[model samples]
Target chain A: MTVSVDEIGNLFARREGTQRDAAPVLIGSHLDTQPEGGRFDGVYGVLAALELVRALNDADIATGKPIEIVSWTNEEGARFTPAMLGSAVFTGVTSLEEALAKQDAQGITLADALAQSGYRGTRAVRFQAVDSYFEAHIEQGPVLEANGTTIGVVTGGQAIRWLDVTVTGVAAHAGTTPMPYRKDAYFAAAQMALELEKIAERRAPRALVTIGQASIANASRNTIAGKVAFTVDLRHHDDNEVDAMERDLRAAFASAAKTRGVEVSIETYWRSPATPFAPSCVALVAQAVDALGYSNERIVSGAGHDAIHLARYCPTAMVFIPCVDGLSHNEAEDALPEDVTRGANVLLNAVLARAGVAATLNAK
Target chain B: MTVSVDEIGNLFARREGTQRDAAPVLIGSHLDTQPEGGRFDGVYGVLAALELVRALNDADIATGKPIEIVSWTNEEGARFTPAMLGSAVFTGVTSLEEALAKQDAQGITLADALAQSGYRGTRAVRFQAVDSYFEAHIEQGPVLEANGTTIGVVTGGQAIRWLDVTVTGVAAHAGTTPMPYRKDAYFAAAQMALELEKIAERRAPRALVTIGQASIANASRNTIAGKVAFTVDLRHHDDNEVDAMERDLRAAFASAAKTRGVEVSIETYWRSPATPFAPSCVALVAQAVDALGYSNERIVSGAGHDAIHLARYCPTAMVFIPCVDGLSHNEAEDALPEDVTRGANVLLNAVLARAGVAATLNAK
Candidate 1:
């Protein structure tokens, strides 16, 4: 997941005793790392499954149900964006061509990256054949380690709302116009942004409001700003807070417009209600962790993942292991091989428990 | 000063005489209005000078400096920025060629407009030969008119500074990257822009801050703003206020940057300090008003004008007229012909008070 988002070169390692069967349970984390990120996040998830395959092979016994381990591409969005690039496409939230055509900052398209990285495949969305999907990852946050838990059985991820604010102002000769004589736009926008922080502060803890993007029109050092636009990303576990905050934020903006003499337009660009882990998937994941003799404390996932997108189509679950000092998607991302093995052990047994799933050894 | 900024038409009038002494004391304002606009601004100023010329002619004062009235081109800079086009060129702030070469929003150059207008002038900067420059304009504010004053003597005009803020952020897909997971540039910029009002507010009652231009990289409704840039115009009559606001604003920006993982760059494109009117010119103006038995008040010109530039070389003064409701630069801008006549009277007297200004003799 570096500069180029194409050609995700991912390899699958199946247990020697594993066999391909209908309705296989798919399990593995993305193989890519966050740019300048933690090593164990996506990589550890895949490695854990591979370790499961290796350990299972040693047992010399093939379960009736088959399981497959595969690593998806562009999970961290380091080189490519819309993170979880593979899963979003797999679930049909995004089209393959669209995903492949997505461009990076350098103007390199995902299709071009695929050709460059040699990871392009004709295979259909993985969810089409899988009975269930499971991802093992390192918890990017310190919640797991702080609680002294060996693993985190994520209950679900939080809901997110992305807002884009575009404020329009007449472009004027800055030097010729005086302060009180002219209508200034950036002033109103800036005030609103600060007010949003105050709103966030009031909402505190649950309502996380971030002013991520700010922009201006015909922006020159010498001209009065003709337009001002920005982005507000607000996440909340509760939908009402999201709704309320949106209203409050909008009201604040409207008032600002009346006072500042500039026109403002806002659009809700994206919205995703928080999706909790399905109870069945949560229970199965817990059972697998218990079978492996590891502690399973639940925590909320602060970040989005492919599982969230896949939730739209099939039941999905995520397993998190501790990366070194709870760091992921960083250059310092590291984890012990044993921890990777332990997480994979749980993943292996969990996949095996699912009915109608099979171990796969398909010839390419 | 329409779209064809270069061609404002021919400049001429009855000199009343043909000799050097017949050249009237030139008095008038620009014909152009700001593009987005306000009325009774430039247009009224010119009408005031013309009304004064008519009154002088009607009175049959053939020996007095024969008054000439004019309407300069591209004053408000609606089509072409850097307002006061004709005046600036005359003052040598920039060359006529440069002004003519300036481009409009449609990317058409001023040279193109000049060709269309057929108004290319052969005259060079005539600061030495020209008589006193007097302009009558609206108060544009409630300062004097509210006090029931009929005339205002401008002591000086405030300085102005224009800036462009360019923020570099990593553009990523808004959907795939969790709000927390992505380094959204627009968000950070939002914080910067939103805080602008607070920046100005902290200095309260004096500091002026505006963000007029805002833009983003890969500006899609569903994309995390990666690269954002905007313009900020900070203006103040008090240099300390401008300095202090800038320092504090930059610090707040740094704080936001530290909190949000984004890079920001601010480039100062324009800076001009406040210019004070000449005491001698101011005295001459006050005399004109006092001699006419008109109400008088000394005030700061709320806007920049040709008088500001001309003041550097020769004596420049501004007379005041009221816009019905103190509105200028709007489509509804209005000023009565009587007010225009009053302003002209002040301008004519001020010019005549200066010795050696030979208009009738020059004409003969």
Candidate 2:
């Protein structure tokens, strides 16, 4: 089945070129979002793709292959998880059963959600078959806003790490169990998080640490925590930095265990090393953005993307457009229509330049 | 029925005090624990009272009233909700019907548990009738450990603020949800904890923020957390610090809500400001500790105590000794028998100094 941006009126065109050697540069973005989220986040990227395609046609230029556009299903996972339901299927990191078998807060499964939405597609974007993947998105942070950069030519994406660390203690009444006599796991975890932040900040400009998930067992206002479990998400552009942070994290945790006289165990959920971008794609985009008179910056992406997933099997590159306050994924997420079009022009020009298409567009 | 250390002995005991404030200072502590808990935690404080009673008798001092030593039924609440189950019942915070109605992990209610153990006493110390209250316990942290001080002669008990903060975000697939598009509650809560720690630490020494209880709405290894809720225990020895910390905590949370594009609601469980000991109670303990050749350094108690609850009705004082490695409520919870004895001796000497006692050989 062919894809199309119904709302933006952008047509999803298939690459006429050979799948790999004469591969068509794939362009797409997530189309779903958080329920109360900003409309511009996912929508902007989709519209940008449409604008890029329209500009290519306007120039009356064609490549050896056709570029495919995508609207990844459940990109927001608003209804269920393992989001990017369509793209994950395309990448094959997860199976269809795992992706579609998810249940929402109300126990509605993703398969049912997809069926109800009337947008479930049958075809997939096989990665081994694609030449390169590209996507445009909001910076999601204040970096682009503070720096006034218009176009970001991503050098690479940061490594991602997920962990669940549990420290178990004895639960007792808070009032009756003398503090000196109580093993309080919650206190130790809190102190560790505070100290861990320092470890990240000291290595800042690159290092980032987040305790994204936390919980305590047998928790009550009047009771000492019996067990505390939390997930720590630590990331950086460098693998060594990520490793060092993890090591330091373990040390801090062990020390806390010793101090609190509690037992601790850490479970790793996912680990991906920092992935390098398609070098030639990055160079081409850098060249194109400079030619287009938009300040091009070789930025390291803080947020992970589908391009990273595609990088495993094929060449991958990412496009970043300035977002207002660098806001994203919220109802307040916004970027001027002008900046978006400017970004589309850069994306269009960059793709054309890379794919050897002599194209021009009135993006401005 | 009259209560004694031996009648409740093994079941629970107070190390007994030599003197009793006419309506004997209703000294209390829990007798049960989660199987792995430390021994000296709840046990030692009660022993301190028993020992105090013993010392007063040895000195042939008599106060005008009958002294009662109590080992409350199931103060640990390991199998139930509040560790101070007896005290809660005594203070009317929980009715005997309610206390008895509650069930343990094994589905045994307090009444059933007590009935099975055959230790429910017909007599309960009238909380309002006590002349004054004094409890000697081990200081749970390095405040005394790092200081080489033998006593945490508390001038005031730290104020406690409990809050349950919930972050609402879209639960999506971990692999597919673009970091910016997913409003992960776990990530949001973790960041919130880190920031809360920062705000507290910035306030320093006084703003003690500990996240003691936490939970995710639905837990999964791969799910982008749909919702997460955690308990924040913010404390300080100063009332203003409590207010300031609460404000900073809420403000930091607001920023997280805005940044993460999620809804955040904080439910306050309780807010108790720094409670000072009655000056007379503080002075008596300070003098007694110094006279007994223990360090007279008066410090604030980091953990809440029965004295805090008792402070509501009667003048109360807390005498603290050091726990080995500042550890408590764990199998690893080891305190020198000598320290336990010394704590009791201090309590003995202190109570004798306060209420005056008749002949006794009271240390249980």
Candidate 3:
């Protein structure tokens, strides 16, 4: 096994295959997590990948294709704008120069950060042929645990749309302004938020909506809110459904503004289309779960992962184990030890299935 | 005319009475205004009082009781808190020591500010006997403008209550959390805001409710809101009604939180009871408006004023004129020239009716 770090700061641990010329099977996830994130989020995936390699070594297994465990950089984007910088660059989805130029809040470029952290390497930051990629991560959601499942065979990543909404009214004295005359912006925004929830509910199990960031401009306890700005996050497994949800969101916000006699503007600031994992890779994960006799379900990744970028260039899929309360990007994020081990086992078998075992020795 | 400033920085201009020892009729308002306030709000009242003295001098009229035009310090609390500090101290509602100790955002005490501005005086800050108190100012509301009335005989300052409300829930991934499982704090807060508006509407025309300040804790565009804090401002003419409104507010908020599976807490941070003006003073202003034959209506001062404190110890009334769109405490606040003149005329006659004219000479 040899360890190396790519120029884009992706850490790779490679185990040579018996048939060295064959393309390697990659198994890993990101290492970076949010500032306030729980330890299990991105770390779980990376550690699980490392554990898979250790388990294979203990079994004295050799494969036809080499296996590389990778830990991608800046997956959380907590300190930068674009996330999954390492994977995006590795897959040619984002150029190395572009990723390196991305700056954090303090204006420190990714290149500067990599150099300062002693992680920048001379290895090329571009994609090469790979047999397949498998990632093991804590299922940062309640679906698996609520269903009493141990393994999630992730088929794809969900479609996501981000919106910036502004509601404008007129500021006046809270005491002086009568109800009939007020065009309160916060009130309009509140109504719009509820409407967004209703829209998501209509689409049920698959649709998700969040009004996460909100603020009243020039807020004062004795003055009416004149302007309010908020962020809306909408997600669905299907691109078409997400698009429809966006339409519903805009229409509902417009109606709410009209009813309140305020002006509303909706801007779709970002969009990430649903990423469908390679059928063969997904099948491998499903087969592994079934062969292991673990309680399992087919699911879509609700949050973005390094595999989303990898899926565009190579066959890729993910294995998920439930975290406590479906919480992530929070300090309280937790996963059961048994479930974590089960997820790593799934990843090991899935990678072995894709990489085709060439020889096996007696267990150490 | 003699000009002097009190230790509390209240500016006073005295017009000697024919009978030297009679208690003076005091007429004026504050000179302080909000940071973003219009030129008219506090300045209008002070200038109107000065205008009354000029008009009386133009007609060479002498009253039995001396008249004093006063401009109170820090009436807006835009610089120092506990608004109407000068009058509060004068009326003994607040001590001079307390007023001086109040500080601005920069930690500069009111005493320091007065000293720096060379306005603080050796004269005592406490109030003395007076025939009556009269103030003329912009209506700071839409009522007079909406009704096309020229004069507003202010009956009293409105009852005011401020509440801080917090809603708590669990934070989860926006994309992963199902609608049924999300106890979204922002959604619950939004519902509570709408409910507050509904509650106020049930009490109609006189009742006013505002969710002036609101914020979600640890807000993220893609994370379910875990907690939300907001301020509610409730006002009415009757103190009992305002108290009832508070009860309705608490019940509604609790219900909304319960419906959303969140926890809610409401705290009444501040309360200022209704200060009804003396009926005799109110009638004097009404009589003056009628004698001038300008369209008039009896209205309550929706916003606080120096007169509220004075009403507690002396006969106090405020004369109001329409400001454009009922706007004040904003750069765009405006009032018509004719309305300003009309308001001052009402002030003049109201003061004359309260302090009897002892002598009159032919108009130069």
Candidate 4:
């Protein structure tokens, strides 16, 4: 029950090592869940990290570096917003003040919720130079299971760019206005979305585009929309490709609007560059899997993880086990017990290699 | 204050003529206004009709048929489900019970609103074969004014069709789903709207199309939409042209969905067939305008009028004066004073001819 919370509500349980002066090796995922969330999506990673520490104690193995198991707050961002808030704050990607000031659907600020939940701690989030970082998670997609593989040595994460688009047109009576005289905002928005999709397909196997959300302001069944706003999400394996895709998207929207005599504006809301994990950290994970003789495949993560933030400051890698149907973030998400054990074993050995074994344990 | 309300809330003010046994010549328009309505749209028609009857009495001219002025309920449908509720019910276009049961935004029934306003009456709506019907109104468009004409003999009303469209696709993480694997609903909906515009342009100067309302269900700024629903408003001067346009629209939507690997459904929500006023009624009004030496032109009404319902069971026609900038359903609607007087004079002479001036005004 000894849990220490950081200012942004991240929790950590520390396991002391023999070398008290050394920076700890961090191992964690997130603890928050989606609304219709699975039981093992995030819980498995935290539990496995704790189990790894227990196994070391049982075997009387001593490490030179401390091991700290972390549970990042609001990783799902389902209740609040901007998922991975705790990791983003701890890694300095976002300020702690901004993270705490974020509000939920009920108009309650993150700081307020943390205080109400009694998880707001006096400790500030200060990043000490870490030995290494590792995250174990269920493969949220069907890549691993479909391949008949048990473990995934995650290589990197996809880059993402979010664009907010606003289209403005003249609002008139839908029945009375002739088509030639209308500058319809919804029509322009539709064209923008279709063009984005085509651009993605033209660069297929690499670029991905999605018109995630769109809306006409004060929409009614009988009134022509005057203003429409939507969001475009573009992802690719390379940062330069994403930038090119975004430029194409912007030009397409401008062209559509100009042809229709409407107005359009595009702005970037978020951008996350592609992240390739440290080669040494990745090799250590791969060596552990090979030693354990577990079937494995090299894979790239499509979904964002706390490891992305940690990668900004230290050596970081991830391990993934197969999930039933490759579905995470859903209530029906499931993972096999044996696969879970294998992923934990990979995590245990990878953590050990980075947090070196003490001479006492080596002698034994 | 001496008005009488029917079961469906239509208000009637009857003036006794010399002959009590003959059918009355009905003359009026709606009294309700649009949410952002003009000062003289429906009010001008009702007030002008009342003034016509008062002039007949002041001139000491008797008529064989009585004159009844009406103010139709919910004519704007701004506070109800359907417009022209009163006239539609009175002329048997819609059932009295159905019109009475229509609800407003707050879930308040038309019956309740009528009751709350103390206008719900016990008087039963009885239709008697009328001698003739005449409606005087401001032309809510620029045709007559733009051409330097003062009066418009409204010969007919345009047919209208409303189609509800729904698009279905797979919802997924906007950031994770690949372009080839995703069936985004908004994209399909956008393509449908653009295709409809093309279809409308192909049948230009005859058929009109407008996408009035659209919505994406479970919309999120970062999640691909699974379902999108919108309404299409189609209009034309001929029923056959409108029918052809609708078929083309449906085919285009189905094709868009198929090509995009999504599902689409189009349903009709409302329809109003084109109405051509009785030739005899139109001619009598034309002759009166000619005799009065008013500059006039025959025009088709772009918007719905109460006379459209009256034309179903009786000889009916409309007289229109120009509105400033051809704008109605707006707060800036304006009409010239002389145009109003001229329209009233046309109404006076037209009513005189249909009701048969009892040999008194005819001799004078």
Candidate 5:
């Protein structure tokens, strides 16, 4: 195994080919886990890619294009946030300096952690040198298993928008202040939450709206809430639909605040636009699954992955194997070995198609 | 000034009279201040009571019954919660043991704090020997000031009920979970809040409903909220009305949770029944206000005071003077000197009527 580390600590294992200058076909995922992470999440994808390289070696197959297995860093983002940092930086979506400067909860910078862990390297990773990318991962939701499918040919990732909402109202004695005199912040916030649910309902199966974090300042059991702040996460497959959803949420909040005699401010914090895989790459992955005679279906990724970042710079697709109950980022996550083997086979064949088997060409 | 401390830290200063067996008239309020308290909230009432005694002594006017002034402890409850601990114990609303056991955020108990401050005493303060009680305070609301009134003869205090609510839903990925599948806790909580406000509006002019504190566990910016806990405070002058308000709030919350397919639990944390002072005592206070030739009005106390506890056991009344903009419990709180003097005169006359002038009786 030939291994190299990039400046941001991405580990790349390359298997040499007949032509070194020919762009390599990249296959990999991240190598991080959530606080209560399962063993198979990021680790499964990395191991599967490594197994693909081993199987090709066992078959005595050399390709025109080199094979590289990558292990991205901080994709879970539980320790250091803004996930998929390694791939984002490699593709130039984020600067290497910024990713290195990112700090964890303990205030330890990424660069410091890499240096301390002895993974810091001078080698630079270039996305332009990657001919194509394929990743194999466990489905983090109940979609595949519930449908009794063994494989999921991921077509694209959903659009994501994060909004920060602040509701300002008059704080008064809960026992003394009459309803007419109150500009209760919680009341306005509650109305906004309810209205957001309604908006999501109107959009139906494609909409995913959630209120995750909420808090009020000077909170007490008896005083009226004066100010409340919460986070809203809206997701959809279409970028225009996601934008419309945000507009609806803002308008609803404005109306609710006005009716309650409160003030509200909604700020869009971060956004990830929908990333659709190249049709040819998606078809190739699906064809591999069909040729292997695996139960499979087309699906969209509910969660972000390194593939989403790589998709922006090159043709990319992902193969998903069913996880037990689709539970992920949790310690209780489990998967069957047979499914893992099937996923690896599909990944190997898909990579072989892109890299072009040199032995087969010589034989011909 | 013969000052003595009680076992629970109440400060009593007695002025002896010819008939020591006669029940003494009690006059005063608490001396504690809020964290961001004004100089004139409880302090004004206390100083006014002390000044009233000084004026009577300077004029050589003695009463038939003994006169005593008390300074209640922990009225603000900012440091140790469940305010009015001293008065509540004095009137038997809360047991002395419970009051002593109540701890602050720092885990310091009331008994420990009093002992550390050297305020704990061996003297046993008895409310049975008290003939009547009068408290002079600044109106902490805009009703009197907005109406251009100088003094308010407080008739009674409003009833207060504190309820705790918890909403439980399913936590899932914001980008993957469809609207139909999500049992969003924040949505249920928000709907309940909005409905509660509407319920209060239905009972408007008297209902005082508020949601003070709210929180979601394991909250993140992208995941759906799994659980939300909040406090609801409802108050009214009519005990039956407050009960109905509680019923309405519970029903609304139950319905909202059911609609959202979420679980909810409502707990009643605390309750203070409405206390109406004796008609005779209220009339005497109004008479004193009229005799002082001040622009006065009969008003109900929206906030809890030491008088409410005392009212349960004896004839108790309160004299309120207008504060600038009716702002209290804030460092920016202010009141005109004339208003203070006017309230003091009204309190003096009321106490004189109850205590009876010994010199005038001797002359007769």
Candidate 6:
């Protein structure tokens, strides 16, 4: 076994295979967690990978391909933005220099933190040849627990789009302005928010919309709102459907503004296309869940994960165990021990399925 | 004429009457303006009273009853809250001690400010007697200008009601939470705002409603809103109508909250009843407008004023001229010079009509 830390602080433990020249099967997840996050979110996945290696060593099992356990850096983006920085750099989605230069709220760069921790290694940041990748993580949602499922074979991540909407009107005294004479920006924004909900409702179970932030400029209890700004988060499993939702959102906002005699401007600040895991990898995860006799369902990841980046370069899939109440990024986030163990077992079997056992081991 | 300053900083310029024992006719307004206010607003009313006195002097006219021009203090409430403090105290609506104890944002008490400015005289703050009260000021609205009228004979002040609404729900990840599983507070608040508009619309041209301030708790662009707080301002000429509107607002908000699976609480924090000016005083202003051959219309004061308090104890009416774009309490607030002069002329005639000219001046 050999241990190494990549330039971007991704920790890796490698066990040589019977056929050493073959590409390694990678089992990876992030170790970093949100600032106020619970104990089991990111660390559970990293420790699960470590546990898989320990179990294989105890059985003296050998595979045709080498197996590598990786713990990626800065997956939460709590201290630094643009989460999954380690995976993003490893997949070449973001440059090594850019990831290193990312700064936290205190203005400390990722490079500075890595160097201070003595984990900034000389090894290359980018991934080389990989046979397949598998990850185990908490579901961070209510679906699995609500449906009484123990394991989730995650096939993909939902597409997400963020919009900034600004509504402009004329401020006037709340007492002096008659109903017909007002161009109330907050009222127009409220209408747009309701319209966003309707658009999401039309698409039913798969579509989601949120108006998480809203504010009136120069807010006063006795003055009509002159300007209002709010953020819209829209998500769906299909990119085309999310695009359709965005169109509906924009049109509805424009119509509401027109009705209120106000002006509206929408900016699509960030967008991430839907990510679909490889079919063979997904099938392997499902096969593992079935072989283990665990109650499971094929689910799409609603939140971003390191696996999404790996899926771009290699056949990849995920195993999800439900956290209690679907709470993450919070201090109270929790998952049942039995569910966690079941998820880890599924991940181990999925990786083994992708990297075949040695002929000698099969004969034994 | 002799000038005097009262303990609460109200300034009075008194002209001896032909019948000295008769109650004096009072023409008064505030001299203070909003922090960011333009040149006119409060100062226009104060100077118009002075102009009326000068015009009578120029015409060598004397009145049977004594006449007084007054300038009230802290009417803008920019520095101290509960506006129209001086008049409120003078008319016994608010105690002088309470008015003196009011503090500015800088923590300076009104009493301290008056003392520092040498305007806190030994005279009592309360008004003893007055034949009638009149004020000339900017309309602070678009109505008069839109109608191309020269004067607005303000008949009464509107009833006003302020409400604080809070919507509470459960916050969840925007991406992970499906629409059916979520309780979004902002969406609920938005629905309530639209309902407020609908209620106002039902009451038509006279009723006014505004959601002037709104905010989500712990706002994040990618998290479902858990709580929202907002202010509702409702106004109408009739107190009964305003009360009815409040009921409508509460019912609509509760319905919307129930529909969204959220909890809503509404607090009627403040209310001011409708005030009707003395019929004889309103008639006097109308007669003056007609005698002066000025284009005019009857108007309800949609905003608060010192005159509202004075009407409790005296026959009170107001004369208003159009301001530019209905702008007030802002640096850009403006009024045409001719409109200002015409408003002052109407005020002069109204005061004279109430406090009849002496037989000697009538003969002249």
Measured by DockQ, the strongest candidate is: 3
**lDDT, candidate 3, A68-181, per-residue tens:** 988888888898878788888999988999999999889999999999999998788785778788888888889999999999999999999999999999888898878899
Model 6 quality (TM-score): 0.93
Per-candidate clashes, comma-separated = 62, 49, 0, 0, 0, 0
- DockQ for model 2 equals 0.12
Assess chain B of each prediction and give its TM-score: 0.80, 0.86, 0.97, 0.92, 0.95, 0.97
Residue pairs with colliding backbones in model 3 are none
Better DockQ candidate (2, 5): 5
Which portions of model 5 show Cα errors greater than 4 Å?
A126-128, A336-338, A360-364, B126-128, B360-364
What TM-score between 0 and 1 does chain B of candidate 1 receive? Answer: 0.80
Give the proportion of true interface contacts each model preserves, from 0 to 1: 0.29, 0.15, 0.82, 0.50, 0.75, 0.76
Q: lDDT tens digits, residues B1-364, model 2?
A: 2443222221323233334434555554655665778777677777666666665556655554545565565566567776566665655556667777888777876666666667655554344466677777777665666667777788878787888888898765443233445577765676787687578658765566656567776565545577877777777778887888888888989998898799899988887778798889888888877787876577787666556666766788887887777666568777667667667777766666665554443444
Where is model 4 chain A poorest over a 10-residue stretch in terms of lDDT? Answer: A355-364
TM-score of chain A considered alone, across all candidate predictions:
0.81, 0.89, 0.96, 0.92, 0.96, 0.96
Error of 3 at B279 (Å): 0.7
Residues A1-364, candidate 5, lDDT per residue (tens digit)? 6899998889999987778898878899987898888888888889999999888877778988898999998898887778999898999999989999999999999999999998887788554578888999998877888889999999989898999999999776676555666778888788788788889889987888888999999887777788999999888989999999999998899998998899999998999999999888899899999999999999889889999999998899999998886677668888889999999999998988888888842332
- For each candidate in turn, the TM-score is 0.70, 0.60, 0.98, 0.91, 0.94, 0.93
Model 4 off-target regions past 4 Å? A58-60, A142-152, A289-300, A322-326, A336-338, A359-364, B54-63, B139-152, B288-299, B336-342, B359-364
Mind giving the per-residue lDDT tens digits that candidate 1 earns over B1-364?
1111223332534344324464345567777775555667776667666666565556544434444555666776778988777767766687766777889999998777766767765544444355556778876655555667778888777666666777776654333344444566666776886677677667655566766556675465445567877777787777667777777778877777778877777777777677777787778889988999988788766567777776765566788776655555557666666666677778777866743333442232
> Candidate 1 at residue B357, lDDT?
37
Q: What TM-score results for chain B when candidate 3 is compared with the true chain B?
A: 0.97
Tell me the lDDT of model 5 at B346.
90
TM-score of candidate 5 chain A against the true chain A: 0.96
Count clashing residue pairs in model 4: 0
For TM-score, candidate 1 versus 6, the one ahead is: 6
For model 3, what is the alpha-carbon lDDT of residue A186? 88
lDDT of the candidates, in the order given:
0.67, 0.68, 0.90, 0.85, 0.86, 0.89
lDDT by residue (B114-192, candidate 5, tens digit) is: 9999999878755456888999998887778888999999989988888899999977767665576678888888888
DockQ of each: 0.19, 0.12, 0.84, 0.53, 0.68, 0.71
TM-score of 1: 0.70
